[model samples]
Target: MAYESSVPYRAGTEGYTSFRIPAVVRARSGHLLAFAEGRVSSAADSGTIDLVLKRSADAGRTWGPLQVVARNGTGTAGNPAPVVLDSGRVLLLQVRNAADATEDRIRRGHVPPADGRRIWLQHSDDDGASWSPPREITGQAKLPHWRWYATGPGHALQLRHGPYAGRLLVPANHSTPPTDPQDSGAEPRYNGGHALLSDDDGATWRIGYTDSDSDTDTGRSVAPNETTAAELPDGSVYLNARNEAAAAWQRVDAVSTDGGEHLVRPFRPQAGLSGPAVQGSALHLGDRGALLFSGPAHPSARALMTLRTSRDGGLTWRTAHTVGGLPAAYSDLVRLDRDTVGLLYETGDFSAYSTITFRRIPVEEPT
Candidate 1:
């Protein structure tokens, strides 16, 4: 199937040097919201960054002017994880840190508690026009021992079935202090995946299934980072994450039967899916019993943006279509309508950070 693509946030435009970490969600009113991290000076991950967004009224054919959702002055505000509530309210979860505090410093526990990574929540009632002030939720969402924190950087999940219906689940990752006091916490083995659960809309949040176990004796472990979530037909939660440590595959996955409170299936390397160690997105096609995943197809490089379909609840996958063959990085999926799906991803000619583009694809084509 052919895809119709357009660049909504391009590098060296709109007073920003680069844009990365693309996330998208379809508002309750049928508006498509696309978000990205607008880097001020350079394409570096750290430094001054702002969470910006754009709205599309008619699918993704065109986008409105850019809107600054949240800015931290000289600090960094990114990792947008947006979800639309049943009441037509949009809640976004993001992480903030000081401009000078890089991931390395935070992972090594060199940054002070006040300067370390923190989580915040914001809401919008009038679609994507305006947003409320960000409320700090680090105390409730993050553990003190965990460092190097990040939200989904994509669309969050809201359970629509089972006893836990209406519950909000945010896929997150964090690095813990090394078990060996002498060892550095910056090691990839310390990275793990978790979920943030909120029962009452965005009023409160609690930590869910913490997957930080690593066996040093056998050198076998699952260190999941940059995670994504999808709901299966049986009302179970499925999580797919990027493996931070050396593993047989680039992705790891787990399943939760009781909403997002606990994981029934532990984190393990996922087979039949190949990609670079990068953030990916997952979407369940309503009651179709089909799950869709989006990420780069290359195993060693962040290129060849591709989409895969899984019929057996993410147990196996088959390549459905390649969105683009150019340099691509992170991506997110949103159901635009009953027959169409929208994708917001990082792709460009020279580098993946050059532009955050949106593509519209037929939902039936992937099934």
Candidate 2:
């Protein structure tokens, strides 16, 4: 059977104007939260991307109005992913650009002070109605670094059995020390991705394995983008990371036996949905035995047309099934119980019609 979907949430600027690029999650209180990088213009202003958040309480059946989590004057404020702390508290994770604080100093090139890349947290004690003050958890204040963003189309899962058993796992890309200019070519250059584990719920954090400087094998420098982790029954971690090598990004799976202390080198010709310069998601669903990979199945994959599923732990994949008729990319999937799976994707065309939308499907259905 094909995957079924519904558009429970969508946001437009002034008059149905699309400003989309989002991340989704299922809160502990059974509410659905979809967050996106609300852009004022079509292109990257790098200074004005805000975190636009919306919620659904009725299991993706309907949604609430759009709410602003954070905003930068002209810089970006995004990487909207949600993590339900062990204490049952829901934390919204995001990165905000400190525009006014760094614009002039960075422009003057006076050693280019790192643009503010602070990690912020918004806590919802009573569901999504109201939130606590956004706190900067990245303690790189003294450093000249400007950004500490985590653009996780991937959801954060808590470590179950280990020394750091209670810590939250978050995957992110480093925006500091922007690519080396001396080495330039047709290749793509950017900061690598890493993980941050929080012990005191959302109060504090300690970072985990960061990516290597570069990978010549993949033809470009290697770095992690959206990385999702699942704890096996034996407690070993299965990490599926979005690898950006060359210009295109592909999903690669790695296994960590020592509780994420280290991961084996990921296998190649990676087994999930990917395309040239595109993003995909790999989620552990249905009692830890099933995996849901959602993205463009073809290299030319565009829109929200393709989604694939693998039941036996990424060893093989069935043919892709379309979730929505729209151009879908940057999606998140999580099992909403046993049989239900919740999804949120950007809907619309290349130039316009952007919206962070929500949909759902069953676990036993065919891909």
Candidate 2 on 201-272: residue-level lDDT in tens?
Answer: 766776665663344455544555566666665566666666655444465556666655555554234544
Best-matching candidate per TM-score: 1
CA lDDT of 319 in candidate 1? 85
Q: Which stretch of 10 consecutive residues in model 1 shows the poorest summed lDDT?
A: 212-221
The stretch of ten residues in a row with the least summed lDDT in candidate 2 is: 103-112
- Per-residue CA lDDT of model 1 for 265-314, tens digit only, reads 67888967788899999999975667999999987899999999999889
RMSD after CA superposition, every candidate: 1.5, 4.2
Q: Best lDDT goes to which candidate? A: 1
Model 1 stretches with alpha carbons more than 4 Å out: 184-189, 213-219, 365-367
